[model samples]
Target: MISETMESHKKDSPSDIKCGIITLSDSLKEKGNEGIEEDLSGQYLFERLSEKYEVSAYVLIADESDKLIQAISNMNSKGIDVIFTTGGTGLESRDITIETLVPRFDKVILGFGEEFRRKSFEKLGSGALLSRSTAGIYNKTIIFALPGSPNAVEMGLNLIYPEIGHLVKHARK
Candidate 1:
């Protein structure tokens, strides 16, 4: 949760931004939607962001690196300010989300993963380190890759979304 002081800081200048929400999971793509848990988390994030900006697009795809790259390229080409992807960010061999994003990023936001793990550790202890959550900018689009779990998505959304507009605006400049 953002502190009251931080929330107040945003009141003075809030950009009406456009965002993209993507869920990376084989099941989601095969089933044609994120499961109930992922769907709920996505909905929560979308509604929260919509309060401040607009969700321009949403996608659900498998954990394949090529597909992930393609999706990101498509979203960036469409002029989305930010792309938030949930799932496939872990140590597992199949968790290539970060790898796929690396070559595409213009500037990697290293602090996001560090801060997310630090904050999550306050709740889940050392287990937070297992998350491969990361954030970066690619072709002027801010990209965030979060763990597959619903709780992880919630944590990332609550902790990171507040600064998304600022990051995107600065990246464009």
Candidate 2:
């Protein structure tokens, strides 16, 4: 069944897939308050995703839910196939990425979060439970909320990269 689905997607899966990388942070700034910082996690996402997809947009914003929503809305308008967000997935007061994005999802990819935590536990033991990394579909675009750590971003992407093309293809259909 899965193989048939992949076969069906091969014809419709976009070759020039466009992706967006969003870094959610309040403390990380570039100059004054107008720009963003280096955003290593976001940069990691850009590099890894660039190998397969065209990174159409990348931005940094605060942990505020409104700001996150605004950023996502803007990205969605740009016809982005996927959006990868790093940070604000913890238990801290400002860690609201999961809370902010989940409710807006048209379909939640529960397996992504479950598998992410399973992989995370192998590397970080019980500490993985504190991470709220997740993935879902909204407005025909796939969104992944990852932990702030660069390691988490890499791991999460590595696990999901294989399915992104198929997911995007099905969503658009």
Q: How high is the CA lDDT of each candidate model?
A: 0.80, 0.87
What is candidate 2's lDDT per residue for 36-90, written digit by digit as tens?
4467898889988999889999888888999899989999999998999999999
Q: What digit string (tens of lDDT, one per residue) describes model 1 on residues 1-173?
A: 76897666556543867888887777656766436355655666677778888889878778898888888888888889888888788888888898898777889999999999998899899888797788999988899888877787888888876677667657786
The candidate that wins on lDDT is 2
Clashing pairs in 1: none
TM-score of 2: 0.91
Candidate 1: stretches off by over 4 Å: 1-14, 33-38
Q: Model 1 lDDT vs. the true structure?
A: 0.80
| Model 2, runs deviating above 4 Å | 1-12, 30-37
